[model samples]
Target: MHRLVLLAVDVALIVMSTLLAIVLCGPQSPLPAIANIGLYPLITIGVAIPVLWIFGLNRTVWRFTSLNDCWLVLAAAVWIVVFSIAGNFAFDGVQGIPGSLPVMQGLLILCMLVGVRAAMRLRHSVRRRGRMARALFRDERENVLLVGLNPIADLFLRCAAENAREHIHIAGILSNAERHHGRSLRSCKILGPPEAAEEVLHELSVHGIRIDRIVLAMPHAHLSRSAQEALAEIERTGAIRVDQLSAQYGLSELMFDSAARVRVAGSEPSVIAASPLSSGELPASSYLRWKRLIDATTAGIGIVCLVPLMLIIGAIVLLDVGYPLIFWQQRPGALGRPIRVLKFRTMRRARDRSGRNLTDAERVSKVGKLLRRLRLDELPQVYNVLLGHMSLVGPRPLLPVDQPSFSAARLRLRPGLTGWAQINGGRHLSAEDKAALDLWYIRNASFALDMLILLNTAKTVLFGERIDHRAIEEAWRDLRS
Candidate 1:
């Protein structure tokens, strides 16, 4: 009975939009000559209602229609128009129906179907409708402030609108650019810069909206000393919380637990034989100790001196693709723990709003190709070295799904920015081959081997990744032995 009623309501909507389309297409009212008007709409109605039934679209809760529902609505619209036109042609002609009427009516039906559902959602939660919504039913919604002027802020807004309306009411956005101040993103006001966050919080409180949380959307942001002092003052309030988007999403540093460290550090691998040395035992060794010191010194100096170059690359990425200057992913580190791997974004968005996947070649821009060729994309990884999630030289980290069974061999030590496998074969090597070459590096780990890998890395960048089958065969022999 409930399904029948919903179907009837949709039919009524279809009828109304069909009439509106006809009237707008013609000069006069479609009311009086309704009897004389063609059967285009009659066929449309006959085909559309069942299409709606088949799609199960009437079952969707309008107040929370999701993106999937929108796609279903789109598909139903296309099929309705195609079948309706076919039905008209089968009847010999659509008398009195203009050629363009069916197309216009189809579009109108789509808009009305999606719009009515969206309206219900807006009425259910937006902040501007807060007073009326409270009168209807009360729910605790956090007055949240978002910091960042990047694409991530926009992503968060869409997500919160679709999912967290009852629990989060975004107060406003804080941008890093002065030009964007007094502007709006997704209808939420861009209050000002992060430097003015304390001032904005005060202003918002004065206007009766108290922010309970602030989320940092950008990966990196710069602030003056006075601004940092101001933020410290806000932090002292003890009433608000600061959150990082990456931490909230559980993107990195999650693979490390006390137990995992104990297991990976002690386990003997079948592929790569290693001395029974843990992280502590290694630090006492002079060579191992110096490796960490060298990694730190090099990364600290490199980061400072490369700032201007990184900035130039950042601008190219922004103009070539869009927001999100940094791209990060979770990859395994030492002791089976994971680190948040960082790099500059090198491709366009993975998919469109409609959820259509794009090919890699299609998404790769000229700037991205150049960055990959010059190896500048790996520059951001120096920060990881500074943070000690990785070493200056070791086996490269691979995504968990892509790793082979012998991947534990690669994780025997901290992952590196460049390694034996990368310098010898890099992108040209298969996963199995990469595992073997990395095992060879593990067996022969030393200061001389590390220097050799670093020097070859320069050659690989100048030339290109070279595949050496002899190296792979030698590593495989050692593994079998």
Candidate 2:
């Protein structure tokens, strides 16, 4: 019902924008001649609705409309103008609609679409700020002192700020760099180096600043010796709680009781794996049921909606590369079980003189590259989701040969069409790096995290940004050490 209302509004906006453009662009009013061009206007509407739907304009949640959504609206409007112009030329030659009219119509449509969404975003922001201010005034918030001046730390700070309902006040940052001391990040000051952790806490307390939590934003693998000592000392003090932000697994508050015992030494702390999930360590049955339900519903709707596109791609692939369009490979599924995963054959079955297959770069066809770029090749994996062999969002299934490297923790979760690692670094990541990401996902799986991954995947697919694998590998190694 909500969708219907949005659709109606969209159509009305498109029509009104076109009419307004005609009036504004032409020397004389085109209202009387609108009767003559009624067929073209109807054609415009017919072309626009589907184009807008294809661009996901109707599906965009207005309250959460972002720059990406605005871009989609612009793209859809451009397509509408292009299609309308083509229709005008085809139906009534150059005498039909003015070329300038289409251009003006497209501009107006883009403005209206983006304007409405922008207004909603503005209103939401204003309300959120108001709520945050009120909550802060009421002292209904936890003052958090974040440690580290890294990207992960920045992300945490941003997330906390955006979530007004959470009422997490970031008091300041504590970094290892002496130069960064007294510096500010997003208005949160950097207190001091790791050695100053105790001093800073005491100072905040002395100033009547109640720090309810101290968040160590550095990844567990990268926790510095001084940071570790500071954490240990903080634990010993027992006045405030400490939280460790694992970039791989997500942020977790480590109470002294539950925190893994660590000795402060000159060396880096060893990366401790989470306990294996046994019969006694399973997730709640209700959560598992809900996850399965989400997977099934997403896959079912995806298959139904995308069948036509898939069929078209299949025909093209058959013509381009000859028979057998679907490529099947054995991959590690839930609990290390072998499952046959399906994808559109993106590479030609080409071999070298030595009877060995060529590299992926050599075997990949032009159409295959396009399919991969658009991520259209993975559409067949919906079948795997429906068959319970995979999930809509989880760790990407690994080849049987690659399975041995992954921890048992990763194997416990169903492999997905898209995952945290894929969105982060994709094919650029090393085996160990990917495994770490997978293990992290398994440990910190949640509905919100899954949705975030899906949203990021959509953005990645839409905008073909290559992941810097080398840089990611270096960062991962640094975090681990």
Candidate 3:
């Protein structure tokens, strides 16, 4: 019912904006003659409604509308303008409508759509601020001490800043970097290094500032030994409870919800799970069934829509790399099962004197580089997804040699074309970092998180920001300490 209302509103707004644009651009007052207008305004609205639908604007939550959402709206508006102009030229020609009408309609429609959504967001924000003020005055919010000042930590602080009704109030930050000692994040001062957590707690206590919880916001793989020790020490003290914010928590809190509910914690150091999954054990959840359904649907649609492109890419690969256009590798899939993953061959079949394969840089062809840059090489994996050996979103399957580095929990799920780790840092992350991300996904598998991963994956692929193996290895070595 609400969607129906929103759809109607969208259609009405598009039509009204088109009419207004026509009037504003007209030399004569009011609307132009019936002959002059012809189907111009009608055609403009017609193009706009479908374009907006394609962009899923009517279904977007206005209160949570973001820059990405606005971009989609802008894209839709541009499409509407281009299509309408072509439509006018084809149907009415220059004599039928003014040249500036379509341009004016596009700008007006874009402003109306984005402006309305922004207004909705502003209203929600104001209401949330009021609630937050009440909560702050009553001292009812949980005082949280954020540990780590990484991207995840920065995201958390951003959420707190944007939403006033958030249940967690960032009291201070504890970072491992010495340069961040006196810096502040979103008005919260960096208290000290993680090693000085206890001292900071005592000082805060002395100053009558009580911290209800200590949240470890860094990636598990990135947590240093000292930071882990600090978490253990803080947990043992029991003065303030400790919570390790996983990818699930961070994403949910930052993107979907203003307040993320705390997961149940066992009476142990929060750094390590009490009963980590071992080999042969899979975490059971209904969400996995939903995830599989999503994987199948998306992969099926993708294969159908991209068949022509796939054929073209296959031809290009064949010409560039010869014969076998598709390369197959035996990767460890769900539950340590061997699965043949398919991809467009991006490298030549070159070997060294010992018959071992040459380095990737030596064998990679120009066409392969372009295919990889656009991530078109992975299109063949749609078959793997359909065959049920993989998912659209999950941990990247590891080679047998790399399996030991990842936890059993990560291996329990089906491998993916793109995963949490891939979107977060992609090939740049270390084995441990990837393992940590995969473990987080395994524990918090949900339809929402899967969608978020897919969205981020699109952004990552579109921007061509994938890091090289040498850089990844260097980062791993540098951060391993």
Candidate 4:
């Protein structure tokens, strides 16, 4: 039902925006071209509907949708207009059609795509402010049957409690394995496991209860092929939807694999599980699709816009540090994986007695110091953002040695170039302090918070507020003691 709602909303918005764009900006000397033509809007919309879906815009949930998603649609619109115009110019030699048509077309596309979305967001914001904040129940609370009672399951349960406002009620827990049958979980009684799935579903459905969704709390590390297949078969019954909640958020396997809730051979194959707590949560596909679209668009534009500045910086770094101006290091990435981190080297070469190395401050060259002061050293990480290895905002990645202890916390998220810590305390923070900020970010990360952080980062960097290094030293010393 939620999926259907999203689809309807997306289609309506897309069509309306397309029509508005044409009416407002379509090529015409005195009157709008779109108002005169009856079929052009329809044709453009028809063509754009598939493009939007292919770009995964409609696939996004309206609630958790971000500006990045809007940016993606905008980029796709630009591509559509640019390519069409270029083809017209190249093949048709641009003699017949007015140049204003392409310009108006591009403008109309951008305005409609962005403006309608903005209006929808305003409506959502107003609704949220007026509402008492609760998820709408369908007849009754969602009848959820959880398969495991492990720590990950517990976390999911906690998520359920937090989002109970969303109306998910645990029907009970089940464990087909003999070892788990007798165990108790809080208020939930442990029924039998996989073998007893049918009997349990029967009893629940008979008593005015509907098993809306089945939850698998099996951690990725402990999942087996047969168990997975069994769950798949159960979901295939169409009687209920199946979801998996696992602790493999940072597992390298996912890097090479698709999301947990992917369709395989026309079936909604279990890929990644929805957060047991995220009832009506935005799908992962929404984020992946929008993030890629935004990253590509932003990076392309940023590179073009910042070309002169980047060149100037490159020349400075080369002259000041000699050759190999860019500093690239392997850093732990999303899901505890590895990716190359790029920055303008902010340090000079300085070796210790063993010829091994020196600390950050000691190695930092004079030019590097100036770069660090301006935070210009980090501009290169925009490429990491472009490559999808990082986000413009997220938990900052850690060096491998710096990551293992906080693996669980960091694994819960994708690493970012600038994050809560960067905006809050940045270089002035101790490891523990940084962790606290990261955890805080993990706890309250939202589109609004990210925007606030981005704004603060700009302020802090442009103002050149030197970090309270003294405070960081004191915090580090206290932690050591």
CA lDDT of every candidate = 0.77, 0.75, 0.76, 0.63
Stretches of candidate 2 exceeding 4 Å from the true structure: 220-229, 236-238, 247-481
Model 3 lowest lDDT segment of ten:
261-270
Q: Output the worst ten-in-a-row residue range by lDDT, candidate 4.
A: 269-278
In order, how many clashes per candidate? Answer: 0, 2, 0, 12
lDDT of 2 by residue, 64-170 (tens): 99777877787688768877776677676656455688888999999998888888889998989888888878989998888777777877878887774448888
TM of each candidate vs. truth:
0.43, 0.53, 0.51, 0.39
Candidate 3 residue-wise lDDT, 1-481, digit = tens:
8877887787788777888887877777674543467777777766766567545788989999999898888867876777777677778775756678878888888889888899999999888888888888888888889988766787778877776435777889998889989889878999998878888988998988888998878654566787678778778868778877766564443322225332322332233233354333556878886777777878766865776698789788888888788798998788778899989999988896679979889899888988888899998898789668999888898777675433456777899998877877777766666665666666667888888988988899888556445534443343332
Off by over 4 Å in 1: 1-285, 352-355
Query: Where in model 4 is the C-alpha error above 4 Å?
Result: 1-292, 350-363, 464-481
Residue 445 error, candidate 2, Å: 42
The pairs that clash in candidate 2 are: 221-479, 222-479
Judge candidate 3 at residue 239 and give its lDDT. 72
- Judging by TM-score, tell me the better candidate of 1 and 2: 2
Expressed as tens digits, the lDDT of each residue in 199-302 for candidate 4 is: 77888778867788887776433445666666677788767887755533432333322344311222211211112211223223335445556656776567
